[model samples]
Target: MSVDSDIISTLTQRAKQRPRRIILPEHGDERVLQAVCRLASNGAVVPVLLDAPTTDTATIPDNVEIFSRRSDAAQWRDRAAAELFARRAAKGTTAEQARASLDNPLLLAALLVGLGYVDGGVAGSVATTADVLRAGLHGVGLADDAHQVSSFFLMALADGRLLSYGDCGVIPDPDAEALADIAIATAAGHQRLTGAEPRVALLSFSTRGSAQHSKVDKVREAFDIVRRRQPSLRVDGELQFDAAFDPIVAQKKAPNSAVAGAANVFIFPDLDAGNIAYKITQRIGGAKALGPLLQGFARPWMDLSRGCSADDIADVAVIASLLGD
Candidate 1:
């Protein structure tokens, strides 16, 4: 098997060993139902459907549990609404607004995760990315140590290596501090998901002092912050993409750097660079991009691409289950 397949197989096996209860809010989507069936069959997760399937019920496995807000007891809904209000009260969310927000499957799914009803949630098939992330932020909130929420794509290259690309889906223009947070969070996530210590590279247009620009300075400052915050981490930066990925370029440009040319986790300067880079890697470089999976959240919640397939949903569900671990 290919290394990407092997990695996914291992992750699925690990998730099956101790299956998590995961919510799929977009039950109306055929792909979500198919993924539910796959998860049930594989024993990778206990797939919880947020509402009754709009399609034929037999397509859903018997192991799947349905939680319909319409059919559920009023007392429980009230409790959930209260919890939502409490969580969002600081955002000027009125009790009525919190109660109404529960009508949204995305928000409800996140609330379920936060209330410990499920281990995690996967949505965004039909919902926009902003709605999905807003639900997670409002309902589940951030990890205690996390200053902000960031995202990473686990790129499984055809060459049999796994790397992480960060801030690709969130944070349009991160300042130095936010960039540092993205690096730290993505590094931890890389270790947790891939079982490899992160060798992080803060990518830039310049290699060290080869060029000068405000953007380069931002990357360098972020690199310094990462080093200060995570002194033991193997990290280097203001590196060009080639210097970060190719040993030959590293030898020429940044020979003494600990993480040069061997970076398993790459932190981009902005969302434009990160998003574009991961797509190019996936399309042209023939890498499997496993995420834009969210990091820095207290619980695991995934945002799927609108174009994601059933297999993609299943893969992400398994990944989310493991992340909750």
Candidate 2:
């Protein structure tokens, strides 16, 4: 079965109360706006385009709320200056410096959220990952259940089985314990996105001691830690991807394991394998990859790489809004 397209449409209809703020950072493009417009038309969010006034005005949608309205060279600029001065005096910022940080649109957006003008932010695509990550790490508090922020992708497979692969979007080269942390966060994300409790197999090249590798040893230890600490979860690993995914292969390779032969989540050994597998699956095999979806933050925040499409923005917005509610 396909994932519901109305995941966005329905969320849009029900999101009338306290709609989140989706801030478009500098050079955040048209395709991005098109996606925001879909959410706007459906009433799911307050879309505030961060900087639309300059030469790039033609790129934005005609009806979208833009920061352009605040700029007029003579009249509004002075008013902006005066307000900046007063606000600076009130907040102990120097007049010269009132405009310093705010000149950076990220600081502006952070001010908006901190002052409670909006619920959250969706950034990246046009902005750098460092830019978005800095804003989030410095802006939002950690969510109650999470100790540290992390990322995950809820892979909506073309075949009807769902899978999640992660920390690809964050936490590079995780240790055994950190991988266990990734597994737990990834499991929660799988449940949140697909309404499916994960049966996660920590994937690697070797299977059940048939071959030896340093990577395999790390995954094996991670599995034990995960099993002991999070007993409610169904997980096993150090299996190959095929074993993790194929019931027959899993049954034969890693016999009599509850997590084997019926796994829904596949945690990769490291960044290289996870990235390559998903990229190959998407570009070569044509799987529908929805996220390097950011999970475990206190507020719903997602990042868009420069390659993101209008639909990608829309999907992420839906997922972020779903998590917020």
Candidate 3:
């Protein structure tokens, strides 16, 4: 079993109720175009393509809106530039620089979302992770309560259970405070997307007092911060993967913890661990990793795996449409 098919079906139905206008900056990419077709066909979103498909123009759907580079600038440049400057002026950005940056496809897509020309933006099939995240940070900005941008993968297990693995694709080496922030952001996102109460576990190489190291100490400290800051949040930490996910191991290891045998959200100690874990689950364990879905942004902007298929893009867009709700 993969992600509950019902969850995707439900989200697509919700998206159709109030279809979001989602801009695809890499419209020329075949995978992006295919995903756009899927989204348009389902009425899940109003697919806005930055540029017409170069090779598959004949396959483009009737409802898909394709904009040339010149046309996009002609239509939205003034508004996008003004919005960009307004958001960046405090950092001493000049109008000239703002206008120049708006010419960038990714930046313009994000700016369109920020300015409300569109509801969200999805790219990265043809862009690097850094490029995708930078556009979002500069254009959509960070959420008020969030310290910085972080990410989460919606891991759909073989047992048809959904879990969140966070800070997997961003924030290379977050400190304890940052880790706490990632956990909070991820937990909130998990609730919003899945409509399930999050039971968060901060994963480390040790379970409770089984090991002693600065890394273990960091996990403990972050766990404390999360609990103290959000007293109502159900969370635990210094848990190894086994203790976090397996009931038998949890009972033998960190017993009496609310999140111990049933963690729906896993916060990693670092990007290295988080990235490795998610990939291993997807490849070796046959889990469906729906994202590296971006979190902590004011407006919804998502990154795609460079290796993602068209189906992956469409699935991520459906989730992005539900973000910022």
Candidate 4:
């Protein structure tokens, strides 16, 4: 099936309400080009095309803004360079190297977002995850109190319901602390995207000690960490899938949890489970998976799958715009 139109419409409307400036680094990619056009045409965001005003400017749509290398030169020669140089210098980049790096679309786009010239950025259509991660960390930096960067997928159920499944793309394995961070971050994202209070569940194979394993202990510890750190947050843990999603099973397994059986956000114990679960929901259960969207960034920066389609890029752009709000 196709992506849920209702989900798209909701995000698109949210984006249009206060359209934010979004930088698209891979303007050379056909998918990026198509997606940017769609975003601009619908007024969801001001699509800023980095590296596009070069010789290939003729193909770009007028509604989109092209931020060429030449335009970035003014910034590179001024205050932006000083800040960018400071960020890169610790990694052994010299003043000259930092200046040159600013001309590259990825770094330049990140600089714009950092400098508050734009609200957020969307890239990775033609870049590696490493490249995107490096640029984002080096430039935009992490959100306050975030110990590590992680990711989540906004799963749109066949019934038009939305769920947040986290740490599926970035963290391969997390200790209690990182898992707590993922839970908190994903809960915030879940609330922001859906406008509903998040009911977060830290997932595991066991439900309230029904099964015994080190893995179950890890999830339980992470749940405790979340509860301690964010006491006001509605969260529960060590829940099996049925306990987390099925009310009858939840009553039997985790009767006291406010989050059980009504969880809109799920934090899986490891990447293996999170990744497998999201794919299973998408492929077998026929859900529309809209992310693997990075979280815990000071300014929003979405890293697309290299295999992403134009529609995927467009959807992510809208999601990025929503982050600005």
Write down the TM-score of every candidate.
0.93, 0.76, 0.90, 0.94
Backbone clash count for every predicted candidate, in the order shown: 0, 0, 0, 0
| Candidate 3 residue-wise lDDT, 25-122, digit = tens | 89778889889989989998888887777785889888887655445557677888888999899999999999998779999889888878788889
Q: Candidate 1 regions off by >4 Å?
A: 2-4, 69-76
lDDT of each: 0.90, 0.69, 0.88, 0.87
Clashing pairs in 3: none
Q: What's the ranking of the predictions by lDDT, best on top?
A: 1, 3, 4, 2
lDDT of 1 by residue, 1-325 (tens): 9756777898898888889999999999999988999999989999998777865987777778887644554665677799999987998999999899888888888988887888999999999999998999887888887888889999988987889999999899999999999999999889978889999999998999999999999999998998898999999999999999999989999999998888899999999999999999999998988888998889999999999999889999999998885
lDDT of 4: 0.87
lDDT of 2 at 242: 82
Clashes of 4: 0
lDDT of 2 by residue, 36-150 (tens): 6676676666666756645565655555566546554335333444455564576676767755656766655544443344456677777887777666654554566666666
Off-target runs (Cα >4 Å) in candidate 2 are 1-21, 26-28, 44-100, 110-117, 144-149
Best by lDDT: 1
Q: Indicate whether candidate 1 or candidate 3 has the larger lDDT.
A: 1
lDDT of 4 by residue, 156-198 (tens): 9998789999989999999999999999999988888889999
